[model samples]
Target chain A: MFDFNIVTQWLDTLLMSFLPAWATVLIECVLVALAIITLYAVFAIVMIYMERKVCAWFQCRLGPDRVGPWGLLQVFCDVLKMMTKEIVNFRKTDQLLHRAAPFLVVTASMVTFSCLPWNKGAQIIDFNVGVFFFLAISSIGVVGILLAGWSANNKYSLIGAMRSGAQIISYELSIGMIMLAMICLTGTMSFSEICQQQENLGWNIIRGHVPAVLCFILYLIAGNAECNRGPFDMPEAESELTAGYHTEYSGMDFGYYYLAEYMNLFICAGIAATIFLGGWAAPLIPDWEMWNEIMLYVPGFVWFLMKVFFVLMLLLWERWTFPRLRIDQLLNLEWKYMLPMTMALLVVMAICVSFGFIWN
Target chain B: MENKSYFSGLFSGIKSLCTGLKVTGRELFTKKVTERYPENRKNNTVSERFRGVLAMPHNENNEHKCVGCGICEMNCPNGTIKVESEMVEVDGKKKKQLVRYIYDHGSCIYCMLCTRSCPHGAITFQPEFESAVFSREALVKQLNKPGSKCAEKPAPARPAVAPKPATTADVTTPVAPAAPESDDKVAKLVAAAKKAADNAAAAKVAAEEAAAKAAAAPEDADLKAAADEAAAKAAKLAIVADNVAKKVAEAQA
Candidate 1:
């Protein structure tokens, strides 16, 4: 009989026999780094095209249809253009920090994917404190924004950086508290374990009571603010700040920052799907015997992508529909509204856990 | 109340998100509207009154009636026209021939003043205004018709003046008969003066009536002001009444 446990044990034994511990670790790190980079690049390109198309649709025009059958290569042409352009560093700027900011920001976002559980047994590093590690590492992107804003030597960038500092720091609390509620219900910080727990009980969204759902919604909003996405993208408000933190970044330097943003978006959505929607869990199909037989042929990375893509589409839809939140409005939504709401939800979730309202 | 359950807000948030999704879903299927610029430009036609380059028309006789009079040159406010006249010998008589009538279409305001001021029935406005060109020199147009010779001339001018009348004795012989004629003329002049005086009196009466009507303008203005104030007050009262009715309906519900 092909039990899931034996399958894992056999694979572990085979891996141990063939490779040294350090060599195996090295291979995994290399593979994960390659996958993350490749995925980020692909998504960033696709997202740019999608955004243009969405904008065009809303404004009542056909977008990018001529490039290569619906303007798929439009982003490529744009990227090529941007790559060839000159990077102009202004006379008044902290050259060192200005140069280093985007690279660091993008690197920070890329590093978060190292701990995410792609599928059942597919992950770069199955760290025990995976969720915490992701939270800790991804928040470092704010440093990039701060560096970009301060080093540009423009007042708009400085003000934008300051606003970003306030925004990320505030929204992070609500996001953290919301994630903490999930941690309470799941009783683990490991993303894979959390997903596994959900598989045992339909989905955390359905199983973990009303407060957990509230936490999920709050986390989504806070995550949006953290990434400086619409309704919360005050950092790069073109109308108010002429591109906010990256006002001075041009050519490939600007491109790097842009790529990092979309990369962060994918990473955030991946985390959200893993935490709430039961990552790669086949839902309500009822043909488990057939699914189990075919599941092996389908790679874990593909499942991860399927789930991530769905979440990305949802996020894009949100971006198109919602009007952006003002800076003061954004902060109030965080400190006054989201923080308190998430805190109360956490308390309620705690009560539900103690009373066995979950998994009943 | 028992800490009104806060899940209501969460439910509302989910509801709003669903509503947004529905809207986007509908939009995804709608036909797109885009004007392909190059394609449209190939078939595009401009309106008749598009105000393009100005042109002056020449007659069927292959002759421009420009008399070298320089009226068009003087009337062109922008100095877009230059008319040069030359003294040419026609049949051994001197005449002013129009050597050149140059028009710079670039500076023309399309005011049609030059066309209107041609006193010799020379030029008329033409509607063929599409005169965009690459070079500035291409915009300059020569008004003179090709191979057209200058018209022949007449002789020079002559002034006419007469001698003054004689005085005293010449006046005495004619003055005796002229005296009676002068009396009759004086009476006719007196009659004409009386009729003029009557017309002046009638005109004065009409002027007084006009002045009286002008004096009543302020009263009409005051009446209109009062009417406007009443209408504004009525609109405000209607708005207040509507608000009250809405509140009453809510209370009843």
Candidate 2:
């Protein structure tokens, strides 16, 4: 009922009829860019607020409730405060790379966000290698993190950046293998195609049974590690590294990193929603036509968001619940355990896919 | 066995993680412990014993318990308290009255010495923690309100274990009541005790006087009579002293 394609299509057609083709394409690009930026701002504000509340609730404390009703406008106030703050410059720092780092990280997050199939016909870019594209773009953020750390001319930043580099790089393997296993089941790397296939094949987790479930669990673990959130947040270990890679960052420069972190969380959850949980697909009750019909009537956009938020909550739950892992333990978890498990699971998924043992 | 242990270890690790999540999950829906201060100031309460600031409480009649003994000032390690007093005529008698009970809250370590050391229980810590002020002078508070009078009735002093009664009637009342004949006997005993006490005192004075006169006039005839009189007095005083000690021991028993 609330499909966003109708508005987007109408806008596209309206612009096409009144303007030149080049100008129309340019306007569409500008609109999409504006939409993505606006989405980033909204998500950053929302996720930060949600995370604070979740963290507070877990600790038996009431979170922010002063700025606006339920502290809804707290993030906006924080943004304003951050904007007016002085981006302090260090004497011996590499000014150029330090300045460019936040932009790079934010750009990487935005690019990855565009690749996700938000709803049917609502995706910004429907790349054939969408999953691979997401993986590639997301890893580019680590480069920005490393640059920020190294250029800060500080020991803490250097160590934090180095730790982040090691953790993200290693965990990326497990993440890739899990996605590969999913792709093996669906026979496509394109997120939209995988999502559509899951709708027909009764959600990959349901169809592939054991291996798929294993894939989902491993993917959450790997994705969590990839995001550099606890229990895998070794680089920006606040207790040890004093905000890790972004130690020297201040003002809106630091705000970018902060925004990107939350946005990265959304992206991680979004990927999980698209791959394992059927992106934009309404949850159906087996053998219950009435329930299926009712669920199907709800907008795909709403379903997509519900799944994303569910995954986001799971990530938030674990983040608040678990303590930060030691650096050695982090690396050991990936290399000795998660990576090997993903590899074994990928093989099992391959066999299941070849034997046509899927549920649907 | 090795493989079994490995799998069990992994399973237990995941289970432990789930257990942690469950604890926080349960806490998430539980009632939050946050007290929104300032907004909830109306509902906020502090412990009765919370030492926030020194205050001398006044009754409805605006009378305080401070006697201005300066004990609190003496006990204060940081010179946080200053108790000043002035002698004022009350019913034609000079009485030390509290003029200013200056309490420098700025310098107060909140060691509770001032409150604990107040002999009259005059000063106590009031749980009014919002004592922040802009001016340094504001922290130096005068605990005694202006135009307030000192409480007329002092707090009752602690009772002692034993008391000395002056009269026979007073002594008999503290002890168990006896027969009417015993009351008369007690009175006569008390009269005799009083006489013995006076004679002992007189003998002591005479003995001293005789000794001094003997030392002055070695060949005087009256010196022998005076010595003899002193010796007789001493002997009688000794007898009286023994009888008084026996009566005192009997009374105690």
For candidate 2, give the lDDT of residue A272: 91
Model 1 chain B TM at 0.40
CA lDDT scores, all candidates in order = 0.73, 0.85
Query: Which whole-number lDDT from 0 to 100 does residue A118 have in model 1?
Result: 67
> Model 2 clash pairs?
none
Q: For candidate 1, write residues A5-101 as lDDT tens digits.
A: 4555675577778999888667656765787778668878877887788767765678887788788888999999999999998888999999999
Candidate 2 per-residue lDDT, tens place, B43-140, comes to 89988999899899999999999988898899999788888899998899789999999999899888998778887789899898998999999998
Pairs that clash in candidate 1: none
RMSD of each: 17.8, 15.3
Residue A347, candidate 1: alpha-carbon lDDT: 90
- Using lDDT as the measure, the top candidate is 2
Q: How would the docking of model 1 be graded?
A: acceptable
Tens-digit lDDT track of model 2 for A138-229: 88999999999999999999999999999999999999999899889888988878877776667878888999998888888888888889
lDDT of 1 by residue, B16-43 (tens): 8789768876776688657675557765
Candidate no. 2 TM-score? 0.76
